[model samples]
Target: MNKKKLIVVENAIKEIAKRDGVTVEFVKMQMKIAMMNGVRSTDSKAKSFWDNISGKGKILTPEELIIHTSELVKQRKSQE
Candidate 1:
């Protein structure tokens, strides 16, 4: 994973854990669940990976968020 995304996820986990005063492991598990819930890309392999890791019955990651966002932006600009 990229540094920025790694930081985002790590910070998110920490922030949530701190707010609830939960353990780091609990935050990590919650993050895995959130990621699975958020996965929405079309790549089956990616989906599978996310699903397996998250235990959320999904296979996607927020890491792809920026990647797909830029792709859509490029596509729209091309059409315009």
Candidate 2:
């Protein structure tokens, strides 16, 4: 992983475990599993996942990532 991503995941491990009352290793493991799921979704049957827009498996542009992140923010707000 890049340094920035490494830092993000490390901090995420801390934060998620603290919030969930789990061990850091368990949070890290679940995070790794989620990432693997994304990769597997990409590799199998050309499914759309974190890196893609649709099943044909085209990589998402930065704009798409921003739009998706914004949607996630709105969705989370609605849940509360």
Candidate 3:
């Protein structure tokens, strides 16, 4: 992550720790749990996405497939 984003996350953790009267370590642990949950959710969504696309009964023409593939590539590149 970038420095500014890291600073924002650090500040958030500090605020949470202060509000809950907990140690920074405790806040960090909770953040870790939340991050792990997010990772799991992403993994599940990716699996479901592939499953939905994979079992499609209709076949595409070569041109159609190329267009679809290009669109997917563009989408992935934009996210990066």
Q: Which candidate number maximizes lDDT? A: 1
Model 1, span 1-80: residue lDDT tens: 56875676667667778999998788666655765454665678767655555545534344454344455679999999
Relative to the true structure, candidate 3 reaches a TM of 0.43
68 in model 1: Cα distance from truth in Å? 8.6
Candidate 1 ranges beyond 4 A from true positions: 31-80
Q: 1 or 3, which is superior by lDDT?
A: 1
Best by TM-score: 3
Quote each prediction's TM-score.
Answer: 0.40, 0.41, 0.43
Candidate 3 collision pairs = none
- lDDT string for model 3 (1-80, tens) is 24564565567668878999998788766655653444345587744543443343343332333344456889999999
lDDT (10s digit) by residue, model 2, range 3-40: 56456545755887899999988865665565556656
lDDT of 2 at 69: 53
Evaluate all candidate structures by whole-model CA lDDT and list the values in order. 0.62, 0.57, 0.56
Higher lDDT: candidate 2 or 3? 2
What shift in Å separates residue 5 of candidate 1 from its native position after superposition? 1.4
Q: List the residue pairs that clash in candidate 2.
A: none
Cα lDDT for residue 36, candidate 3? 40
Q: What is the lDDT of residue 77 in candidate 2?
A: 100
